[model samples]
Structure formats: structure tokens, C-alpha cells
Target: MYALEKPQNFHRGTSFSLITRNGDDRSETSDYTSEDEGTEDYRRGGYHAVRIGDTFKHGRYVVQSKLGWGHFSTVWLAWDTQKSIYVALKVQKSAQHYTEAAMDEITILKQIAEGDPEDKKCVVKLLDHFKHSGPNGQHVCMVFEYLGDNLLTLIKYSDYRGIPLHMVKEICFHILVGLDYLHRQLSIIHTDLKPENILLLSMIDPSKDPRRTGAPLILPSSKSKIVSESEVSKDAKASCSDLTKNQKKKIRKKAKRAARKCIGKEEADQDIEVSSPEASHRDDKSNGEPSEEKSRNSVGENSNNDEANDASEGSRGHKRGSRSARQKLLAEVELKCKLVDFGNACWTYKQFTSDIQTRQYRCPEVILGSKYSTSADMWSLACICFELATGDVLFDPHSGDNYDRDEVALGGRYSRDFFNRFGDLRHIRRLRFWPLNKVLKEKYEFREQDATEMADFLVQILDFVPEKRMTAAQCLNHPWISVGPRQLAPSMSENGGSDKKQETDEREAMEVRVGNMAIDGAKNGKDSKSMASPLKQ
Candidate 1:
């Protein structure tokens, strides 16, 4: 079929009527069995493709193609013809149809973006907002800069081969920058931080590329460049088949160019006889340094690094750098991490009133029924930071059921695994919300030998007591977070030995207290309901 070619004089700024010569009226939604749809719908189902050339203008942004949709609004890949760039359009299905939670989210997003300078940059930029009438009613549309895949996609495609340490750090640091902006600057709380929400500006490499390492970048061909307003108007009037073919060709060319570019200048110019062997050896050595760290990070696999790039496109550049340079780069990264997502960040004092993040990344404070603030964000930062360094999540539960309600209502795996490891904590000190002894017996059958290992990591962070959990600042000082002296744990004090010991002791005590409280409540009639844990949707 021949594509409809429109007149070149069509201006983007002017309003134009879109006449449908042929309309295929079809609507079939797959409503799953589960009623809860916070963010899991995308995972459980497929996203609907927008009708090609069906134009919807929101202020300066003209809706192009539907990218994805969630509970509150539908996300569209759009063009800001005036700015000459591609942007994400989040249009509300209908203003009147919005739930109270959805309305609150919209207001919170606006406040965070427009509230503080630091917060503004951390969030996905809000370019414009407008009202449009859908078949149902009036809708609210928001425009944002379009980003590529999220962290989850990057990790899934990583070939089960871990991501480079530096790249992991880069992603974590960037997220922190955004988190800090939200918690510290704007006093907002994200309540949600997971692989899905973390979007990549560009694809480090195509999903099919052979080279899987090196600096992250987009295939030049895949790189979105602004099309002229006239061209966009003409194209918007074209048919679906025509647009799909153009997009495919555009992707293929970009992939080829990306492959050519993957041939590093150093590797490309080296002597053919020995260079390949030498280069391979160097890569191995770099990979060697982070092995232990990677294992520790992988224990849970909460992080999904496949969201940002495809493993098919491997690394090609320098692997490890000098300690000094690495430290400097790490510091610079920590400083810049304030750029990722600030629209819904919260401070230590802020209470995260809404369910915003993915299940795993949600902090224990958020999980247990505690008020959210910077501390909660710090927890998320630590999780992401760990993922960056090791390519894994810290406490991702294996079972699919919502652990929050299960833990409270039925006292989950702690019945078997926890007590079996820690032995009966009957003789241990009073924990915050639980009965120390009863909980030990009823939950994880605590063994004497299990206490040490159990007390070491997970229990400390997932303390069930929000106040007792470590803050991101505290995590920055932990050995797991640091590599060595002003070298590894640069965020910590090397010389303040006694002070560090005291702080550690205090944290330990807090953990014990919180544990006791939870167990005690379980034993008694008192409510141990925490504000940290979330209600399953």
C-alpha cells in the first residue's frame, strides 16, 4: 500500500485535524486474575501498541507512539517538535476517573520537579502538561524526555555474566544522586526504587551486538535525533506498516555502526600477532579483581541490570584503572548520582505515603510500616549501590507471594530458615517489636551456630524496625561498600577507630531491640503493626 505523503508546509505548532480514512476499531484488554496492579502488570502482560498516525497534542509535545502504560497514566514516546527532541508523554486516561492515590502521585511529582534545583535534575524532566478528551472523558497528559530500557532489562540480558564493577558503580552512584536530591533537597520520598523505574538514557549496546563490555552508549542509528516538524507531521499521517519498516531499517543501520564503533582504537591498532591474546588476558585480570565482591552482591539477585543494555553488545574499552583514578572517578560519580529520579524522593523526616517502587527495592522501613524519609532512600541507595558493585540484590525473597503480609500474618520462611540458622534467641536481648525468645522458636528455629551468620548481614538491614536500619550514609562507610583506605571506604573514617566501634555497637543494640519488639508483639496481644511494610495491592 502506498503511504500517505502530506504537504511539506504543515507546521507543527499549528493545530491540525487528523482524518482517519480507514479506522480499525479494536479493543481487547487482558485483565489478569490479580487485582493488584502497582507495577507488575507490565511483567505479567504485554503493552498495547498505539495506533500509528493517531495524533494527540499536549501543549508543545505531539503524541507519537505508545511506549508503555501503568495504573495511573499511559506513557507515550512523543516529539517536542519545538525543542527538536523525543520526549515521554504520560497522559492521564481521564482527570475525573483518577483515583485519589493517582491524584496524590501527580501532585507529588509536580512538587518534587518544581520544588528544588537538586530535586529537579534528579527526576525525569517534566517538559509540558495538557488536557485532552479521550473516549471516556477529559484526560491529563504530561510530557517527559524519552529514555531507553530500564535497569531490569539490562540485567536480564547480561548473559548471567555479571556487569563490570565500574558500570555497576556508575548506575548506583547516578541513582544516589537522584535519591539525595529527593530526600535531602526536596524532602520528597520515592517510596519506590527498582530496576524497572531506573531508565537508561542510551543503550550501552544493542541487545544483539557481540561486544558486551566498555563504556555505555547508544547505537548512533538507534540514537534518537529530532526530526523536522514538517517531517513529523507528514509521518504522523502515514500508515502503520510504513512506520514499522522505517523504524526497523533505522535500527539495523544503527546496529551496524555501533558494531564498527565497538572496535576500540587501542585494540583496533594493536599488533595482530599478540594483541588479541594480550587484550583477552587484561580483560580476565580486570574481571578477577571484583570476583569476591560480585559473589556477595549476587546472594539475592534483586538487581536486574539487563534493563539498560543487551549482553550481546559486550564491553570493549579499558577495564580496570589505577586506584587513585578509580577513587576520583568513584567520587565524581557519587557527586553526580543526584541526576536519576527525584520526582518522588523523600527525606529522613518525610513519610512515604504511597506505594511507588517495585517490591524488592522497597526498603524494609517501607515494608514494615514505618514512616519514610531519607533513611528509606538510603536503604534503597545501599541496595542499588550493592547491585552496582556486585550485580545483585541484597534481600530479594525467592517465593512469588507478597512477603510483607505473609510475614506479618503467617510469619513466613522465618519459621524454617531463620530459626534453623539463629537457633532459639530465647536468651537474647529484647528486640523492638517482636518477642526475642518466642519469635526465635516460632519463626526461624534458631540454632546457636546460625546466630553469627544471621546477625552479620540481612537481619541488620531488614531489621524490621525502620529506625534501627542503617542509613545510606552509614552504608557508604561499610566495608562492603568500600574497596579500601581513602581508597576503598573513602566515605568512612580510617583513623577514628574507637568512634566507629561505638557506632557499630549502637546499631547492633538497635537491631536487637527492634527484633525483640516484633517477636514480643507476636507473643502478646499488642499490635506490632509497622508503617514500613506495605499492603499488597
Candidate 2:
């Protein structure tokens, strides 16, 4: 799940809600679960029932609010009393399997934190961890540095029109940096890499950020009652009550339209089901002014007509100004982000499951039941880059024949299982070959130069042969990623050559390490092509 907190003003309108979901952490009953983590899971071996004022690890971390929840764990926004700062507290379920997963995640997080002492690896940092014994059972709680919204929220803020090319390049650079660190230095593979797992460093809106807004931390109180999920939902609704009816209606319409564009038809249908009548009623009650109240205030309507007209004009100006301000904020947003949610991550030689990665980001080799390595993550990164550029998934497979729409007939250890000797899919007869460049130009209206550059960078990583896919370090040096202003590595002139020399030396060292791995794989009867070979360059 994502390790970040949603702003208090955020509402669940789009299907791409900021709620994080690890690759295989979702439970079977997730389809029918409520908006919140349901009460059904608050049993002896289930989720620890967390309250607003609850304190964990002997009052070191104080729960402020629920950040999000997944089948494996629940994340909370909490105050770190020891450090006097906000943090994300992830409380895992006490079930045996969940406990094992937590232990694995903790081990990976510790390695990451230890390796990146300067915190420049673009991965989330593990702050503190402890076991909390609750009524449910002893739960493994992990504390992480509190981050801002995920890339999904950033996409929504852009109205699903997609961000600028420069911004996309900036975000891609950061993601590749993180992936390079994981794949090269730590030998870890983030099995799941998607927009939801990448988070910005700060909130999009300054007013909503606790640090920026000088918001007071919620102190622990013995008299405070446990806040139920229903009460939390009500509180979220109340926060948006001041929005005008027309404004709320506009938001809903935009959200539904964007949801349809973002998610597949089946997922969209599920979202429609989950948006029940009771939820609509709550929205209506919260957003609409009551008729009785309007009638009672009608006595002064005539007298205040002139004042109302002036107020209306002022409101229009304020709305225009607000729109401009929001645009400015988006333009000035820091593009730096970090890779988060390592629950499904595994080392190159110690994979926990064959079924890794979410459906949209799953690679061809995995689908074909072949061997996978760090290259699988490169495929997912390519998909995410496409999504960030186009505001839609690179591959959105549906049921039946549609599921093989993006499948390519490539030679692999298990290729014969799904493909014929003549290089054709056994089950799917027909195929439409639309190259990445064509898809961008014809479908998304990308300019020729932009389409070609993007296709060049992504196609290498999206190669059917896993061993031939570009390494993260190679991708970092790609021309497409270097188009924008360099943020991760400054120029020699900007830093008096010392930092640049160090950066270059590090990149060279990583390439050498990757080359050594490739040689080792080749010696073990793998492909002759080195993973560090820059296919396009």
C-alpha cells in the first residue's frame, strides 16, 4: 500500500482513489468491502482496531487519522513524539501470513535505509518499528517518514489531461533513480511499480500540508473516544460541506468522466456498485443547502438583493483568482518523488511469489510463466511512464480474447506453452500491431518528435525478451530522460565539477556492476547480450 496521507479536503470521487493496493495483498473479499476497512476484519487475527487518539510503541507515535488501508495492513498518520514530527504508521494484520510478509518488508526497508544514509536514493525511509499487542493480536507496526500524495492524485489534479513533457521527464528521472538504486546497489526488485506507489515529497496545496499550515499535532487524550469508520467518513464529508452546489456537481461530473477514462470497464462497473445510494444521500445532505433554511432566510432576501449581487460578482472574481493560483501551484510543484510500498518487493535470488506485479503493469514473460528478474520492474516502469505521459494505462486488458490484446509472440522458455511453433498465439488467432510511436501519435495526438523519443525509450524496456530489456542505469542515461533540466545530477559548471565527477563515477560503477551480473548470467547458460548494453544509444 502507499505510505502517504491524503489531505483532509480530498474526497472519493474518482475510481483512481489514492488508496494504495499492493500487488497480491488484496483479500478475496476486497470486491465487496466497504469504502473503509470493514469491521469484519477486526477479529483476533485481523486488523488492529485503531482509534484517532491511540498511541503505539509506548506513546512514541500518536495516531492522528487513517491514511489508507489494504488487505495486509492499515496505514495511519501519526505524530512521532520522540522526533517531534509526523510519520506514517503502518499496522499489519496479526495473521500468520501477514506477519511473515511484515517481517520480509521490514528486512528490505532496513537494508534500504542503511544503504542510503544521505536519503538520496528516492526510496521511502523506515523511521521506527515495533510490535503492538492489541485485542486482535500482536501486530507489527512500521513507522515511515510521512510523504505527500501519490502520483495518482497528481494525475487527478491535472484533470487527467496529462502533465507537460518536461514534468513527465522530471518524474521519470526520479523513478529511474530509485529503480537503479534498488536493482544495482541492493539487488531488490519492486515487483509492483505504478503511479500509486510513487509519491511526491510535499502536498500539492500548501494550505493542506500540516507542516506548512502550522497545524497542531493531535495529542493523546485518555478521555477521547474511539472514532469509528463511519464517523471518519462523516468528518470527511463535513469538511467539504462549504462547497457550493454547482461546484460539487462539477467535481462529481469531472470525477466520473476521468474515472471512465482512467480505469477499465469492469473496474468502472465495480466503482459504480460501490458508490451506493447511501453515499449519494450523504453527499446530498452535506453539499446542498436545506429548503427550510432557505425559506427562513427569505425574509431578508429582497432587502439584501443589492448586497447579494455585489457578493456574487466578488465570488466570480475569487473563483477566477483561485483557478490561476491553482495553476501556478501545479507549475511550481517539486517533481521529486520516491518509490514506496515494499510489501511485495523481493531480491533477485529470493523471490517470494511468481505472481508479482499488478495486472496493468505485468510483463509478457510473467504472463507466459517464464523466469523474471529486475527487468520485470523495467517493464512496469515503462507502463507507468506511458500512463504519466498520456493520462491512461499503456495496456488495459479486458476479459476473454481482449486479455491477449497486448501479448507479443516472443521466444522464451515457456513461449511454446501459449504460442504456436509458427510464432502465433494458440488461443488468439488475430492480432493488431500498433507500434508505440503510432499509438502515441494517432491515439493520443502526441507530436511526432515527442512520440518518437518516448517510443524509443519505452520500447527498449518493453522488449519481449527479459534479458534484452534496458537496465535502470541505462535508462537513466537515455536521451529522452535527459531532455529536461537535470535535477538528480547537476552539471559540472553548476557544482564546480566535484559533484559531477562523483555522479559520473557512480554511474560508471553501476554500469560495471550490471555488466558483471550479465557476464555471470551468460556463464550460467543465459543470453550473450549484456544487460548494460544501451540498445538505442
Scored by TM-score, the top model is 2
- What candidate 1 gets wrong by more than 4 Å, as runs, is 1-50, 95-103, 115-121, 206-357, 388-392, 398-405, 408-464, 468-470, 473-537
State residue 45's C-alpha deviation in candidate 1, in Å.
Answer: 20
The clash numbers for all candidates, in the given order, read 89, 0
Q: Supply the global lDDT for candidate 1.
A: 0.38
For model 2, residues 332-366, the per-residue Cα lDDT tens digits are: 77888999989989999999988777656777667
Error of 2 at 279 (Å): 38
Error of 2 at 194 (Å): 0.7
- Report clash pairs, candidate 2: none
